[model samples]
Structures are given as C-alpha cells and as structure tokens.
Target: MVLAVRKSVEWGITAAKLFVRRECRILSTLPEKQEYAEKQIERAPSGRKSITKKSILESRHIYPEFLPDPNPNWRNSLREKLEREDMLKRRGQVEIPEFYVGSVLAVTISDPHAQSKTNKFVGICIERKGCGLRADFTLRNVVDHQGVEVRYDLYDPTIQKIQVLRLEKRLDDKLLYLRDSLPEYSTFPFDMDQEILPEGSEVPVNPIQVVLKPKPWVERWERQELKGIANIEEYLTEKNKIKRELRKTPWEKYDLMKQYRKTIPIEDQKEIWTEVYTQLHQLQSAQKKMSRKRVFTSPKSLLA
Candidate 1:
C-alpha cells in the first residue's frame, strides 16, 4: 500500500512561524555590543547576562535589511507572512494605480514647506525603467522654449496621486531623443486636463515626428532607436557604420549583472504577488461601497 502526504493550511501557517523563530535565533548569536559590554562586565558583572540579553532583543529593530527576500530555503510558510506585512506598509501610505508608459499623467507630490503642500507636474510618460521598488517612469514636457524631462520612482514617498490625463502610446520604447528635437512636438498646454476614455477603449497614438537641433546634443542620437527621425537614411554615412563596429559587444559582459537585476523569479513571484491580489480585492470592495453611497445621495435618485 502507498501513502500520500496530506497538506493543510494550518500546517503552512505553522511553518511560517517556525521560520521566523529560526531567524531570531540566528540574529541573537550576533555579538551583542561586545565592546561596550566588556567594560560593563568589569564594573557591574552581576546582571551582565540579563542586561545583555535584553539589549540584544531590544536592538532587533535596528538591524539593517530586516525585510529581505522571503527565504533562503525553497520558501516555506514564514515567507508569506513577511511579504504580507510589507505590502500592508506600502498600502497604508500611497495608493498606487495601474498605469503604463506613453500615458499622460499629472503627478501631485507633497512639498510641505511650499505655499501649497502639493506640487503638481504634468507630462507624457515616454518610458518605464526597472521593476519592483526600483521601478521609475520618465515624463517629458516643454517649458520655457526648452524641453524638460523628469524621472520619478513609482513607489516614492513624495507622490500623492497619479492621474492618467491621456492614455496613449508612441512608436518607440523611449522618447528621450525628444530633448534635442523641436520644442513644438513635446509641448502641451499647462492647463490641459485629464481626458477620461471609456472602458475598453483603444489607446491613442502620437505619430508626430520632431525635428532635431544642430550638432552637440546630450546623447549620440544615432546610438538610440528613434522613430521621429524622418530622414535617417539621409543622415547615415560611412562614419555611422565605423562607430557601430567600435561599439561592438565583447561577449555579453553584463550577463551576470543583468540577470541579477531582472525581477521574474518564479518562487518569489507567488509570495510577493499574494498580498497585492488581496489588497486589490479590498480596494474594489471599498469602491463599491462609495458608489452605493453616491447613488443614495443623488438628487435625481432621491426624487425617483
């Protein structure tokens, strides 16, 4: 006869507790103010053990990287609990929204000392860079006869709200070259407001090509993939090909670092995303309640 191993939800939760207990044990073994303790041991050695143990436990909060990747082992229950706490911390402060590159956004960030506690910056997102807490987006707009670009971390503490004024896409991944291009293409009216598209509507396209300035720009325009370059073939010469050869990759030098930064690890994906899914469901429930409240208060609904 063969026997099967039965799994239980209670067991999973228990395993998680044990995991944290083990971490505490490892942390406790670390030298607890050995240098300072040595002097105290010589002076008043009576309650040395008691004071040192208390100090070790009390100072646990100051340990760096207290929040780390779920687990060293093939993740057990404890990892899930830590992940939930992290997600809740993120939720308590800023409300992150669903957004993508090429969307026009008005980001209001808190500036306490300013005349108004909020400062709003409106621009079109040209590109998204990185993932997780490191994720950031680049916003571009023309101001004072010059193009201006600002990169903001998606999860940064300063951002109050991110309103999608216009959700759209461009032909290229990044529109950084727009810096050296004609200001007219990048410019938008300062007073432009959000354009709310109907649900399931198609994303708009910005097919405008911008003209570039004379030589000596911030970047070698040729190195970047730019769609706005109308006369690219005309600009190309023997010099461009020579430059490409000089910049040849020497056997993928960045393979290890690139892999390290990539965020799609299979096991971590499950635990990290678990809390997000729960919070999203909670947000949906709260929105439903607000909708119900509004319907009851409306003058037309009350009359009917």
Candidate 2:
C-alpha cells in the first residue's frame, strides 16, 4: 500500500515527500535501565579480607529474552513528541477508532514487496501486545484453507491504514492456540471488506473464548496459567512437572543482583510515566473536544 500522497501544504511537494519518507525504528523499549542499577557489594565489617569500594562495583547488568526489545538509536525524543502530536491531528482528520484483541480488522500495510499497488491483509486480531512507541497487534486468519497470522507495528510507516471490522478483546493476550482451534475462531472472508464503527460511537466488545492446543503445548503452558485452554491439569504429564520444577530458579530470589540486572530503574520509570501521563492528558483533551463538537451537532451522541 504505497501511499503516493502529494501535498502542496509542505511549502512545496519536496517537503511533503520528505515528511512521509520511511525511517528506521526499533521493535521494543526495554533492557536499557536494567544496565544502570546500583549494586552493593557485601563484606565483613572489619575482617582481614577487608572491604573495598571499587568503581566497577561488580558490573552486574544482564538481559533476559522475555523482556521487551530495545529502543533504536534513530529513535529521537523530539521526533516522538512530534509524532504523537501528528497522531492526535490525524485522529481529528479521520476518526482513529478504538480496538482490542479478538477484534476482526482489515489492516492495510505498505509492503514494498507487493505486486501492482495496494497490499492488504484482513484477519482477526489474536494478540494485542507491546507498549510505548513499539506497541503492536497480531492478526490470525485462515486463507485458501491455510492458516495465516501477521503482526503489525501500530506506528510503523509501513502501515498505510488499519480498519477495524470488529473491535474487541479476547480472554487472553495471545490467541496463538487459534492455530489448532475450530475454523470459526480463525476464519474470515478472504474478500472481506472493512467496517467502520459510527464516528464517536462506542466500539463493541467481543468476549469470545478461544480453545487452546492439547498437551505438549509450545509455550510454558503450566506457568503461563491460561484459562481458555481446557483441562490443563489433564495435560500435565509427570515429565512436564519435572521440567517445570527444573526450570524454576530458586536462587533467583536471593539473587538481588540478578533481579537488578533485569529491569528498568526508578528514575527511568519516573521519566517514562511523566511523558505518558502528559500525552494521555493531551489525548483526553482532544477526545473531549471531539466529543463536544459531536454533542453540538447532536446532543444525543453523548448519551441520553
């Protein structure tokens, strides 16, 4: 979906084209603050061994895979501030509808590999995951008797448009189990067109439960503690129990340094939340203004 957008508004066409140029972006924003934790070294009060405060201080910063990915170098604070402002502006220009997992959506991504012109994929949103600038959603739909799922970075320039056919959340964050579930849970019309929820109207929630795969699931099924999966206890084999026990790191609790090596620090959290809250306020104000305009047009739009 290459947007051949030409605008006279960017002083001239060159600036507008430059404005929409594709820029590199990172997938996640975790693991950085983990590297900056202040760790303390232990020693006897006054022993022959002696206590020394070295500048290195044990150098204990390690990362785990499960944590969100890292932010990219090209990721600029000023640019992000501007991007958020633009998203707000775009919402006013076109209604940016609300959506959640289990919502069937028709997402149009700008694929350079696409043949002809527009490249689009329509599927049911199985997973709505990630946060901050990297937040993304996944769509699962079976096409041509084959199952297919695609994940899209919400704010990626590669995304031409996202149209919600059904906007709702599921019982779980990830519906990967839909892979083996019944066809109805994962099926969507191949030629299904987009649906528009009425402007400023309530986006309907679909509380559908999806069935999971049987025993020997791909993920740590027991630890994750999924509800949608039927009779997990029955699936728990003796070997699975041993694997779970072996996988557990009892020392991890006593390991303050280990825990310190795996998370964002207090200062970073303060900075992130400060920006998040400020942005949320801005979004709220914009929504309120949009609501007021709608109410002015029709008092009934707000609610009886």
Candidate 3:
C-alpha cells in the first residue's frame, strides 16, 4: 500500500511537469505565430482584400432589376425564375448600359408612325421604378420651350438602342421633383455627347440643387424631404413646415423589419448574382471590344 501511494504521487508530479512544459512551448511560439499572421495579412493583395470585403454581392447596385420583388405577397419563386430567364434573354438582345435617375440617356425605339420607322429621344432620367420585366424609366426634357416627359419600358422589344450620355447619380433616388422645378433642370440637348468615364472609376454624384416653381405644383413637395431642391423653403408656409415636421418618421431608419421587407436577403442575392455573373461579364467584355473597335475605326472613317 505504501509503494502504491508513492507511485501515484510520482505519476501526478510527472503529469504536472509535462503540462507545464507543453504550456511553456506554446507560450514561446505564440509571438512568432502572431508575427507570421501579421506578415501574411500585410502581404495580402488588394484584389484579394476587395474580394473578401466586397463579393459578387456588390453587383446588386449595378443590376438591381435582377433582384425579385421583396414583397412576400408578390414573391413567387417559379415566376421570378421565369422572369429572370426572360430578362436575361432581353438583355442578350439589348446592350442596356448602366444608368441612374440623374444620368442623361438617349433611347431609340421602333416607331411605325415615325418617318424612319425609328424615334430617338434624349432627356434626363427623372424616375426608374418597378422590378423584373415590368421595369420602366421616365425621361424629361424641354423641347421647343415646352417640357416633355417620356416614359419607356426598359425591356421593350421595340427598343433598338439605349445609350447613356452621362452616367451620374442624383442626391435623391427619384428625380420626379424636377418636373415641378425649372425646365432647365430637366432639359438635355438632343445631340449631347456621351461622357466616357475612365475604366474602374466610381459613378459621380451631382449635388446641384434645383429651385422649385411657386405653389400649385403637381405634388406636395413640402411634405417630402427632398435633398436636391434648394428653394423649397421659400414655397413652404409656416403651417406647411409644421405639417412636414409632423409627417417625419425618425424611427423608420431604425426599423429593421421595414428594411428587411424592402430588400432581398444577402445570401439569396449572392446566389442570383453567382448564376448571372459569368454571362454579364462576357456581355460586358464583348461590349468593350466593340466600343474599342468603333473608336479606332471612327477616326479612320472620318479621315477617309
């Protein structure tokens, strides 16, 4: 019994010594491992860093229409899949360039009544709404001193060409307020030249604020908080200001449920973009090649 107890105590001491040695080795290597990790992080390429931070999910801003309606009532997975297929087919047919509400666009559509069987209109995009194939955009321009607005179906078969003369964003998502503002704000020359941005440049935002026309406007501009309008306060009375303040829902921004309802889930968005990214990339490459060819041949043609 004495020998057995002595053996047990010896084993316990041996085990404790082994544990201490193991812990000491780990502690000695910890700084080296940490330094190696820091070096790896520092040496990482920016492209890989960007991939980790911004994946295919960033494509959402470029192709927002590809996302299905977030409304649970309107959501039909099969229908959305079908719509996506149709939208891809239409996109294959038409090279619809990236554009925003404030961008200048020139659209040419097949018109049976037109002398040339095609009609071209140039204007500033005032609004873009809807999802899937039902998506549409409105363009406003002053022609012959009269304000004219044209609404066109984005994926219409009749659309021959969609050109972005100027690709830029406005302060507001929708520029419908331009309709009530000065005609100059909505106007664009029909022969406006395309402003080609350098490759990989971010879309520029126009911060120009518009002056609104006096009362008797189309909509109650005072009720809506418009960042692109400058002279809205001049048109608003004390009562109007009070009503505007009363209508403000400061808590809406903090309402996660409302945001969730308005946008598709990130995981779902990744899946959708993953399926379409390859095709979109191919289309973009083809377009770039064609554009380069055109640029090179144009000068020679002009000289000839």
Candidate 4:
C-alpha cells in the first residue's frame, strides 16, 4: 500500500511539470511577444516587403505570353509547359520589347530577294493575335501611295531586330479596322525616330480617334462599338445605327462567369509569375551586362 501511494504521487508531479511547461510556452506566444517576433522577422536581412499591385501589373506586361489561354477547352498543362520552354529559348536569342496595338514597330528580317540580304519595314501595329509559337502581329503603313501591311510571326528565327519607335497604347485593344480607314491614319515614316519615354514613367495612351473611309467596310464597325474611331456615325445610316443598337448585348458586361472564363485569375497569375520571374530576371540581367559591354567597346577603326 505504501509503494502504490508513492507511484500516484510521482504521477501527479509529472502532470504538474507538463502543465507548467505548456504554460511557459503559452506565455512566450503572447500577443506582445508575437508582435516583437514579427518585427524582428521584418527587419531580417533577407526579408522583403510584400509584392505590390504595381509589380504584378508590370509582370503582366513583361510576361504577357506566360498567361495561358483563358479558354477552358484549349488549356493543357503539358502544352503550356512546352510553349513556355520554347518562348524562353526564343527570348534568349532575341530581345522582344513590350509593345501594344497602335505602337509603331520597326522589324528587320533576312530577305533573299534584297540586295543587302536583309529588309526592314516600319509601320504601326494593327493587330496582335495567336499565342505561344503561333503568336504574330500585323503592321500597316502607307508607302509611296500604296497601303502595305506585313504580318510577322513573333517567334520567327529570321527576325533580326524588332524595335519600337513609339511605345504607346491605344484606346482600343485591336486596331485591325485601321485597314478600312484612310491610309494616312495608318501611315508611319520608315525612318521615324524613337520617342524615348522617361524611365519609371507610365506609358502614354494615344487618345486621338481615327476617321474611317466610306463603306463598305471589312466588318460592321458600328456593331463592334469601337472607341478609337470618331467619325463612325457619319458613315452609318439611320437604319444601320438602329440595327447596331438592336444587336448590342449590354448585359454581357455583367456576366461574371464569362469574364471569369476569359481572364486568368489573380491567384493563377501570381503562381505563374512566381515560376517564370527568376529565370526571366536572370536573362534580363545578362542582356543588360552584354549591352553595357557593347556600348563600352569600340571598333578598331573608331579608336583609330
């Protein structure tokens, strides 16, 4: 009976010790101490502020192709993986600047027919379509009273240079209707000088509205509800305007599911950027170093 009583007393002491240890842990995790710990963490050498909304937007611009097609039927993880690999490989070979529809571009490509074995064209981008390896853009310009539109594949290996002479956005996304408009609207000089924007400044959007030529147009411009064209009404008859009004589906704008299906979710975009950011950052750093070297180095003839 004395031995049994000693065992129970030992059990009680062990339980008390566990309770005191837990209490000490709880005290250590109190609100004040927790805040102090967080402060210390924020002040750590490798700590960084949370990613800003601006940074996310900038990533969206710099890595636009990284966002997979929003079409549910077209999405395939393996295909996207292969495409990104190809895109990165191409990027390593050439520098593709961030440009949008209505931005003037100068593209130099190897041409067997040309005497110099190279040809260069400059025009305003009218459309950008397709994705991955198939991505391409159309540039329209008036050369010697003739309208010339050249479509170039973004990943084409023969492209020597793709320079943006004027970097600006348009009020509308696709400027394909520029074809039906007057030639002057799409005209850009071949030797147009680069309009350099101040570093860290926001890209300007050209708000000028284009005037379209008299019908028949390539498409129903009135139905498209284009914001970039100003004189659309002058070309439309009363019946045409009425038809356009009847065709308008204003309720489609409020269709939440449609927008969700057509756009990449913010979470998905963040995850994608996380995977691509490091590799792209490294590539950009290397390009910067190479460019600096080229700028510093001079030809022997120039030195002489």
Clashing residue pairs in candidate 1, if any?
A: 16-77, 16-78
| Candidate 2 residue-wise lDDT, 178-201, digit = tens | 775656668888565445345555
Error (Å) of candidate 4 at residue 118 is 1.2
* Worst lDDT 10-window in candidate 2: 55-64
Off by over 4 Å in 4: 1-54, 285-304
Instruction: Show the lowest summed lDDT stretch of 10 residues, model 4.
Output: 295-304
Clashes of 2: 0
TM-score of 3: 0.80
Model 1 per-residue lDDT tens digits across residues 1-304:
1222235556556655654454223233122322444545644755777554443343222221222332344444465465455645664565554445556778888888878888888887877764335557888888887777888877678888776666666656677776776677677766765554544444545565667766557787776556766654455568986796677666643343243233223244433344354565576466445434432221121101
lDDT of 4: 0.74
Q: Clashing pairs in model 4?
A: none
Answer with 2 or 3, whichever has the higher TM-score: 3
TM-score of 4: 0.76
Models ranked on TM-score: 3, 4, 1, 2
Model 3 misplaced stretches (Cα beyond 4 Å): 1-55, 296-304
Better of 1 and 2 by lDDT: 1
lDDT per model vs. reference: 0.56, 0.52, 0.76, 0.74
